[model samples]
Target: MDEYDFLGDVAVAGSVDSFDRAITPFLSQAFHAKSLLAIHFHRTRLPKVLFRWIPDKTLRQLFDKRYEKLGFMVDPFFHRAFLVQDWEACLLRDIAPDRFESSEYFTNYFGDTNMVDELGFVARIDNDTAVHLSMGRNQGQRRFRTNDVVRFGQFAKILAPKLRQILINQPADDVVEAQPLDRRFHAMAQARHTNISIREAEVAALIVQGHSSRAIGLKLGISGLTVKVHRRTLYKKLSISSQNELFGLLVNYVGADA
Candidate 1:
């Protein structure tokens, strides 16, 4: 199908619910991607998924059930979409932080996906919102090459502008208005004991997302020792002894919200 037909189907689908059936299959074949996930980002509220397709059942289940709630915080592609402020296809390994493969988030949540690589399109609608078109290579598929990324980038020059306009005109569901993650994170942690501070809650959020103490410190602009102190304190406050327990608590928290 041509670009217009592809986008026409997307627009006619109305809301994001139909996106999987409308655009995912076409894009997958066009890009030779094993999985595709289209997400609409809200600057403050939770993002809305426009479309999702994964060939692997276990990986798809993990993405739907846990990624948005926990693993997303550590996702470089997701974070970069906000920072890039432009349309481009980005490779995951090129942008991933040092020691990322060794991090708990990757070892646990991300590792479970069995995906070999990812390339994402950041379609910035404005300062407040953006749409992400992410395509991935699963374990058995070949990795995206430099030339392929270049082609995708060239394609973005066409795809992004059209998509931005389509999104503006079609206007999928409004982004939910809600408190920032840190505040809400703190509130949830305090359900058992209201001793978690806002900063500690921030630390907890990153921790659950699979950041190491050192990485968390770097991102938060503090020393490794400070991160350790905060980690210890929050662990005591939440009555959790290990990262596994903390993850379980947050998983339950997200499930409750659902």
Candidate 2:
């Protein structure tokens, strides 16, 4: 079994802000890197800003120009892994390469660029969106390792649930009905579209029905710890960190009586 196999319990219950906080300190511990940053694309038609590193005005202008040249604005449902051979040329090409090269399944799209010598991953939030995450190590610092990428992927996997809970568990315009997604919450919607198993959905429904963790465990014929794990996974998948947040989101988006 893969290291993440235990996460299958994500199908049972929800509400896990404490768990999310619990795992964050390990992000740095799990991945060795010169730098790591994550930016959330909350809304569209606004500036595709960065919460982490401060870009100089000149660099910011160049980044903006790159976005315009990209032909596609950031939106949800976009996933790309990049390995850069040239940094300057990447700005010229306007395409971010996927970083996970060891996995045959994770392909790199922009290889001809002359500036990149490392890898990165970018996942957008909307079709009309202009959000992107472009993180990589310089040629000299530390070559991007598969294990680092794997750890980042794990962090992404965990972060997904929290984001999902936050988006779907509310009436926020950005969080639309799962059936007819408008492409705004593509990242969150896509997780629900795929990954979320039927058993998991059954668990979520039960949680909404006011089932306790122990009761849910009994109903599913699983242990209470298993139920607890599932609930945490669900919260992460839904972008929810707390029970109150889950209730609010379900009441707002799913029409579940709050």
Candidate 3:
């Protein structure tokens, strides 16, 4: 569809629900995407999965079970959209790291997924928040062409203002705001009474806060090896094995608090 046709559809979208219904069909048709995932990023907090349209139950479960963990932190698309101020639409391959395919994030989380390619639209909702709309293609499908990216970027620019309005008008009661990971970790630790040491708690907090072992060590005036040891001890204390499990623990705590 042309830009005018797309705008006409947007014009009729009076609410968030209507906007979502209208746009997803258009995006699915226009890009030949198998699914969509919309994420809202807050400057100092974990991202909220605002909307998802994955039809495959297994893919959805994999996202919840695996990708919600440290894998997201390593995703170039997430890092760029969340950290960078400029908003634009781009293909995932265009921004991925040189060694992305060999990275643990790819091998363990993304590579196992059915998606072959992803295109993202970064829509700024406010100074501190942005909505990332991802369009995914399943395996055996062709990657996005240059003209497709250009056209999609143009469409995203046109849609941004309407998306911003929809988000701004969303009811506060309906929104589930994610608290900062470090704060949530502290709260979880306090409620557990699990004989976790202060140092271990600190390490765990930083880990959930998306800090690398080297970075945590630097912050704590210790070595990376010490940070790893503390992390292992903390995980053993909490009976969690992976970062995904730790993330699930924090999410459970947040839900209980809510």
Best by lDDT: 1
Q: Which stretches of candidate 2 lie over 4 Å from their true place?
A: 1-47, 54-61, 68-134, 169-258
lDDT scores for all predictions?
0.74, 0.39, 0.71
Rate residue 121 of model 3 by lDDT.
77
Worst 10 residues of 2 by lDDT: 84-93
lDDT of 2: 0.39
Number of the predicted model whose TM-score against the real structure is largest: 1
Can you write out model 2's per-residue Cα lDDT over 50-101, one digit (the tens) per residue? Answer: 3223123443443444322221222111212112211111121233222123
Q: Using TM-score as the measure, name the better of candidate 2 and candidate 3.
A: 3
Q: What is the per-residue lDDT of model 3 for residues 167-202, given as tens digits with 9 covering 90 to 100?
A: 778764344344444555766877887667778867
| Stronger candidate by lDDT (1 vs 2) | 1
Which lDDT tens digits does candidate 1 get at residues 180-250? 55666676776656668888988877776556789889999999999999989988888778877876676
- Evaluated at residue 14, the lDDT of candidate 1 is 43
Rank by lDDT, descending? 1, 3, 2
- Per model, state how many residue pairs clash: 0, 42, 0
